[model samples]
Target: MTAKDLESLLTIYKEVVEKIDLGIHVIDSNERTVIYNKKMREIEDMDIDDVLDKNVMDVFHFGPAEESTLLQVLNSGETIPNVKQTYSNNKGQEITTINHTFPIRENGVVIGAVEIAKDITKLEKMIQENVYKKGDTRYTFDQILGNSAALNEAIETSKRATRTTSSVLIVGEIGTGKELFAHSIHNGSSRADNAFLSQNCAALPDTLMETLLFGTAEQAGTEGRPGLFEQANGGTLLLDEIDSLSPALQTKLLKVIQEKKVQREGGTEDLFVDVRILATISEDPIDAIAAGKLRKDLYYRLSVVSIFIPPLRERKEDIDLLTSSFIEKYNHLFGMKVAFIDEEVKSYFQEYNWPGNIRELEHVIEGAMNLMGHEDTISFDHLPIQFRHKSSSSGGSNDLEKIEGLLYQPDKAILPLDDYIHEAETYYITKALQHHDFNVTKTAKALGMSRQNLQYRIRKYNIGKNTHS
Candidate 1:
């Protein structure tokens, strides 16, 4: 390529990065910002001039216990994907984002780091202000879908929980709607008229969490702020991801639960609080205890009313209902008239395990809806590339049947040798794409070819375009 061509290509890449919806921040090994995209500036509420050529720690006021994910990845030379992080900028504006930070390497040596962030600050505020606001939880028992035996049993247990103010521990895998159940319990109880608040134990450092839970005392330079316990007095307080709390914090929490009071940091007096504690742990209490992630005394106290929500794979019968619900939800949100999914796609959903549970199914439906146009129904082709690839790799019966039919049908005309080879190559590449979830880099690695070569073949065969159809 000529110098002018290279320059044009670079310009195009820069424009694409700038215009992308996700915030992109790249830092050198020395921790100086190299590329802070427009979206990143908008997300962080900072000017490019404030970030570019500046140390990330200098720009963001990270506490002593907290570290930037970008810097962590830079030093560890590892990828940290899909992590929810909450931090404040230098101006004290708190920001929440889901970041995928990766280490940039050259010739097998770590050089710098890049972080792609999706800002969720507004989402967090909405949850705190509206969803978990006083007497205004958006979810109730009626909103908990799925009639599977396991789910129904859990629902029954949760319903019983609303009858008493004892601490309840909700145990389940991630994305199992533990918070939804917590909201339902709060809404149904006698304390339903009071404030309902929630805080994720894993989202902040211990010191910050300490202040957030037990308000700080009025000191000479700063004013006193009521914590979630005080704010949620006479109501319900949900401590989400409770297993992430340190033992010391757990002991403090136990004291609050037992004494029905909170003594603010640096304060001498204990304020009485009638807040009912409802905690959620993604792992079983037994497992969490064995793993030393939860205090035994705290576990026993919190499990006065234990509710275990079954994983999606365990409640396979609910997949169809959940899928329909998600479809309806996205249709209204996307303003698309998707009637239903094809039987094959439904079967694929049933057969495949949803590790992310209902949330994953909902996301799959949402993702497929994004790829739709005038189509009223979601077919195999409409499914996300990841789902399609997983289905192919699982060797579904339908796939095997199709292959058997193709081979056994003697009435079908045989193609020339070159034509047959071309068709076979297309099929293999299409399956490879499915297996790799349509990731060009991974597919190339598995196929023993360069990514450029795989892209050329993908274009030549139009692998993803019509294969699903």
Candidate 2:
């Protein structure tokens, strides 16, 4: 290409890099910072002058045993993809990012490196506050609001787990109160006075998970942070969705449980921790193993005291008790005296399959209550459209009459076209959800829209509330 053409291309490349949502940092082979994009400045909370033309080590501090991703790639001339790194800027503010770092080479010789970073500082902090923050667990045996035989059996077994420090694995489907059981076990244990922290394994990438679980060591004037294992010392640490952990992490977890010691992510020193580990899985351990999502040896190690909680479908009898509890809870919160669920609504609840389980049922009740107004009961109409129109035989006449009323009433004020379109879209989506038996994936496919787009519309329109009459 000619010089003018090359200049134009370079200008376009710079513009695109600056406009990109991800943070971009480029450093020479000597680790001198060269290109720091606008997004990178925002992520690191730095200005262009703060980082440009400076050595990376001078701009950002890494732990003694750790190295900058850009430097690592520059030295090795290798690409490192999807790596989560935690470091501090010159201002001593901590930043966490998932980075894809690549070497810039010429004729098989490394010249420089570029790092693409997605800032996850806020996300990491949120997860840490959730799982590593020191606090007393909220749930105990008395608070686990179910009396079904299946649930009670699981509770009894979990209570047994409190008597020993052996690892306990609570297995149940989503919304089956597996975390509740974990908390109850911890509260009932001898170490109740200590911390009870929990982490959802599925909530983070493997790199972040590793660092958060094991922690980082202090080095080179930077402070170190404790991982979950250390934070829960002399207490209980619950790893929810344990099966979501990668094979490598599972093996490391097994070693920690067996050795009763944990080494931080970048630290050479191993710290002994007297933490009782509790874990939960949303599926059968055997099934997870067969599917290659879980490690067999790790399962054996964690399931020393296994407690299985039955799904809401299996324990349908508890629906009344759960329904009453939720109603009372919402009643107190909403300051509305909803006296009962109409028999038809109760019957429909029993007949419809709750793919989302207890959580789904609870949300349904919540949504219905939002539309209750001064009504004394939750009726067929109060139920979300998905549930109200599940059976084709029901609501056909009423739905037709409601649409007719909207279209034919000359005395009614004309609504904005946008409002009419909004209502129509809501009605159509509800019909699609009903046709698909409330399966979001199937409905989204049938509607030729993404599931996320459909979900956004549902929330935006409050589609379930009154179903527009």
What are the TM-scores, per candidate, against the unseen true structure?
0.61, 0.65
> In candidate 1, which residue ranges exceed 4 Å CA deviation?
1-131, 394-469
Minimal lDDT window, size 10, model 2: 391-400
The Cα error of candidate 1 at residue 306, in Å, is 0.6
User: Considering only N, C-alpha and C atoms within 3 Å, which residue pairs clash in candidate 2?
Assistant: none
lDDT of 1 by residue, 183-236 (tens): 999988999999989888887767657867887677542356677898898899
Runs of candidate 2 exceeding 4 Å displacement: 1-33, 37-123, 389-469
Per-candidate Cα lDDT values, in order, are 0.84, 0.82
How do the residues 1-469 of candidate 2 rate in per-residue lDDT, one tens digit apiece? 9999999999999999899988999998778988999999999999999998999878889977667889889988889876778899989999988788999988989999999998879667756477644455788898777778998899889888889999998888898888778888888889888988888898888877887888878754345778889988999898989999999999999999999999997689999999998898988899999999999999998889999989887888889888988899899999989989977577667666666778888888998999888998898668776655453324333343464225557877776777766766777778767755677776665465788898888788776643221
Task: Tell me, by lDDT, which candidate is best.
Answer: 1
Clashing pairs in 1: 389-434
